[model samples]
Target chain A: MPKIAVVTSAFFIASLISVPMGPTSVHLLLPGIVGVLLGPAAFLSIAVGLILQCFLFQFGGITALGANALMMGVPALICAALFRVLQNGDRRRVVWSGALAGGLGTALAAIFLALFLATAGDNFFAVAKLALAAHVPVVIIETLVSAMVVSFLFRVKPELLSLPRREDAVAVKEKLEAEAKESESSS
Target chain B: MNTALSWPESLLVLAVLLAPLLLPLLYFILYRRGRREGLVAPIVSLAEMAGGDSFFHRWHTGLKVGCLLITCFLFVTLRTIPGCLAGLAIAALAVTVSGLSWRRSLARLAAMSGFLTLLIVMLPFSGVMQADEKSFSLAFLPAALPLRLSGLHTASLIVFKAMAIALLMEPMLATASLAATLRGFRQIGVPVALTQMILLCHRYIFVFQQEAARMWRGMRVRGFTARGDWASLTAIGNFLGMLFVSSFERTQRVYEAMLCRGFTGEMPEIGSEPIKRHDIGKAVFWLILAVAPLVAERFLHDFTQFFHK
Candidate 1:
C-alpha cells in the first residue's frame, strides 16, 4: 500500500510538468508509462490522476469522472499487457513497444470518449467524431514522448520499469536494510 | 433579464453580461506577469474557506456531498434553458451564501470556454436536420451538410448545463475540509480505501508541484526555452525522468518515516459531530430547493408553459 501510494504520487507529479509546445501546453499523460511500470495497478493510478485533474485543474468533470477513468484505465491495462508481451531486453524493443502502447492508449481513450458522447444522444455524433479526430495528433505526440521517456529509463534505471511483484519488493527492501545495517556496523 | 427578447437574443444578452467574468482569464493570458498561482490559489483558498465558521461550512459533510452528487445528476438531465438558468442561479447563491469569492468559480467557467467554443463551432454542423427546418449550405462544402439552427440550441443547452455544474462545484468542495469530505464519501458507502488513496494522492500533488517549480527554475536559469524541436522534447523527457526518480526515492523515505512513527494502513478518522435531526431537516430542505427546477420541468411543466404563453 505504501509503495502504491508512492508510485501514484510520482506519476501524478510527473504528469504536471507541462512544457509549452507552440500555442498549447503539453503535459505527459503517461498512462502507458504508468501502465507498464505498475501493471494491474494501472487502473488505480489512472483513477488518482483523473481525480486530481478534476479538482485541481478542472480538466475532466465530476459527472464524467467514472467514464473518464474507465476510458483511460482500460487502455492503460491494455498497454501494460502489451508492453510485457512486446518487451525483450533490447533498448529499441522497449522504446518501440512503449511508443506503440502510448499512442494506442490515447487512441483508445479517444474512442471511449466518442462512445460516451455518442451515448448522450444522436445530437452528439458530430462532437464525438470531432473529438476522435482531435486526438490523432495527441497519439503521435504521446508516441514520441513515451519513446523518449522509455529510452531514458532504459538507459538510466531499467530496474524501475521491471514488473513489481509484492514478494520481490519485500525481498529487495529486506536486502537493502540488511546491507545498510552491515555497512553501519563496519563503519 | 430582458423579458421581451427572443430565446437567441436572451442567450446573446446572457453572453454579453457574462463576458466581463472572463477578464481575469484575459488578464492571466495577455499579461502573464502576475502571481501565476497555477491552481494552487484555488486549492489553498478552498482549504482555508473550509475552516470558516459559515452556514455551509457548518452543514453536515454527508448532506453536502449527497446534494452535490444529486446536483451532478440534475445537471445532465436538465434540458430547458430556464432549468439551466435556475440551476446556475442556485449555484451562484450557494457560492455567495458561503462567502467564498466568485472569482475562482468564474475562472473555472473561463477555463472551460475553450471547450465550449469548440462545442459551439462543431455542434452546429453535426446535427441531423429536421424536415421543417431550412438547411444552410456553404459554397466551400459538399451539399450534404446538416447545418441547422436547432443544433445551436442543443449545443447552447449543453454549454449552460456544464457552466451550472462547474459553478456549483466551488461551494460543494469548499464547504468542508478535504478529509471531512472524503469521510463523507466513506459515510455514503464509497470505499474507504479509495477515498484514503485519493487523499494521499492529492496531498503529494502539492508537494510535487513545488518540486516541479524548483526544477523548472533550475532549467530556466540555465536558459531552457521550450520549443517544438527534439532538444526541447529531450530536455522535458530528462526532467520528467529525474522527477520520477527523485519522487520514487522520496516515497520510500516517506514510507520508512511512517513505519518509524507506527504507521497503520488505515487513515485515522477526524473527529466529527454526529448528524442532528435539525441538520437532516436543513439538508432535506436545501436539497429539495436544489432540485426544484427539475421538479418544475417535470410535474409543473404546465405552469412553466403558462408563463411561456
Candidate 2:
C-alpha cells in the first residue's frame, strides 16, 4: 500500500516532464505503466492524485475532476488486465504487450474523455471530436515510451514486471529475515 | 422577420459572437503568459491563506465539504441560461463573502479557458438543429452549416456553470487546510483507505518532486535536455523507470522503518471545531443557494410565463 502511494507520487513528478508532439506538447501520463506496476491499486492511486490536483492545486475544476479521473483511471485498469493476460515474460512479448497497453490505454482515455463531454448533449460533438484528434500524438509517444520502460525493467528487475502479489511480498520479507539468521550462525 | 444578413453584416455578427471568448483567451496568454497552462506542478501554498478568520474559515469543515461539493454538481446541471447566470451570481457572492482573493478565483478561471473557448467556438456550427430552436447562416459561406442558437445556448450554459464552480472552488477548498479537508471528506463517508491514500500521496508528492528535480539537474548537466524528439522521450522513459525502480527498492526499508514506529492505518484528526447551530444555518443557506439553480432549471419557463401574464 505504501508502495502504491510512493508510485502515485512518482507519477506526479513524471507527468511534469513535457514531450513535444508536433506543434503542441503534452506531459506524460504513463497511467498504462502505472497500471502494469500497481495493478488494481492504479485506480486508487490515480483518483487520489486527481482529487489533490483538483481541489488543492485547482488545475481542473471540481466538476471535471470526476470525468478526468475516469478518463485516465479506467483505461489504466483495462490496460493492466490486458497486459497481465497476455504477458509471458519473454523479452519480445513484454515489449510488444507494453507497447499495446500503452497506446490502447491512451486511446481509451481519449475516447472516454470525448464520451464524457458528449454527455452535455450533441452540441458538444465537435469539441469531443477535437479532443479525440488532439490525443493522437499522445498515443504515439506512450507506445514507444511504455515499451522502453517495460524492456528496461525486464533486464533490470524481472520480478517487478509481473504484478507483485501481497502474500508473496510478506513471504519474501520473512524469508529474507530467516536467511540472514542462518548466514549469521554459519559465519 | 426575414432578417437575412448580407456578407459583411454576417461577418460582424460572427465577430461579436467570438469576441467574448477570443479576448479572454488572448488575455490569458498575453498578460499572464499562461502561468497555470501546461503545468502539472501542484500549487501547494494555495491553502496557506486559510489562516485568516473569514466566515468560511469558521464554518464546519465536514459540512462545508459536503454542501459545497453537492452545490458544484448542481451548478453544472443547469440547462437554462438564466439559471446558469443565477448560479454564477451566487458563486461570485460566495467568493466575495469567503474573504479569499479574487486573484485565486481568476487563476481557476484561467485554467479552464482554453477548453471552454474551444467549445464556445465549435458548438454553434456543429450542433444539430431541433424544433423550436433558432439558427443563423452566413450569406457567403456554405448554407449547409447553419449555426444553431440552441447549440450556442448549451455552450453558454457550460461556460457559465464551469466558471461558477471554478470560482466557488476557492471558498470551498482553500478555506481549510488540506488535511482538514480530507478529514471532512472522510466524515462525509469517503472511505478511510481512500482518504489515507490522498494524504499519503500528497505528502510524498513534495518529496518525490524534489528528487525528480535533482535527477533532472543531473540529466541536464550530462547534456540531456528535454525536447521534441526521440532522444528526450527515451531519456524521460529511462528517468521514469529509474524512479520506479528506486521507489520500489526503498519500500522495504520504508516499510520496516514504519513498522518499527508502530505505523497503523488510522491517522490522527486534524483538530476541527465542533459544529455550531449557526454553522448548520450557514450550511442550510448554502444548500438553498445550491438548489435554486435546479429549481430554476425545472420551472424558469413557467416562471417567465407567469411574470409575462
Give the count of colliding residue pairs in each prediction.
0, 0
| lDDT (Cα, 0-100) at A63 in candidate 1 | 87
- Top-TM-score structure, candidate number: 2
Query: All models, DockQ values?
Result: 0.40, 0.47
Can you give the lDDT of residue A165 in candidate 2? Answer: 46
Candidate 1 off by > 4 Å = A163-187, B1-45, B134-147, B302-309
- Among residues 3 or more apart in sequence or in different chains, the pairs in candidate 1 whose N, CA or C atoms overlap within 3 Å are none
Stretches of candidate 2 off by over 4 Å are A57-60, A64-66, A118-120, A163-187, B1-42, B139-141, B250-253, B270-272, B296-299, B302-309
Q: Report the C-alpha lDDT of model 1 over B39-111, residue by residue, as the tens digit.
A: 1133343475687766678878887788777887886787676787788788778888888866677667776
Q: List the residue pairs that clash in candidate 2.
A: none
Candidate 1 CAPRI level:
acceptable
| Candidate 1 local distance difference test against the native | 0.74
Can you write out model 2's per-residue Cα lDDT over A24-142, one digit (the tens) per residue? 77767777887887788888888877877776545666677777888889999999999998888567998899888888889999999899888867777888999999888889998
Top DockQ prediction, candidate number = 2
Q: Residue B237 in model 2: shift from native, Å?
A: 0.9
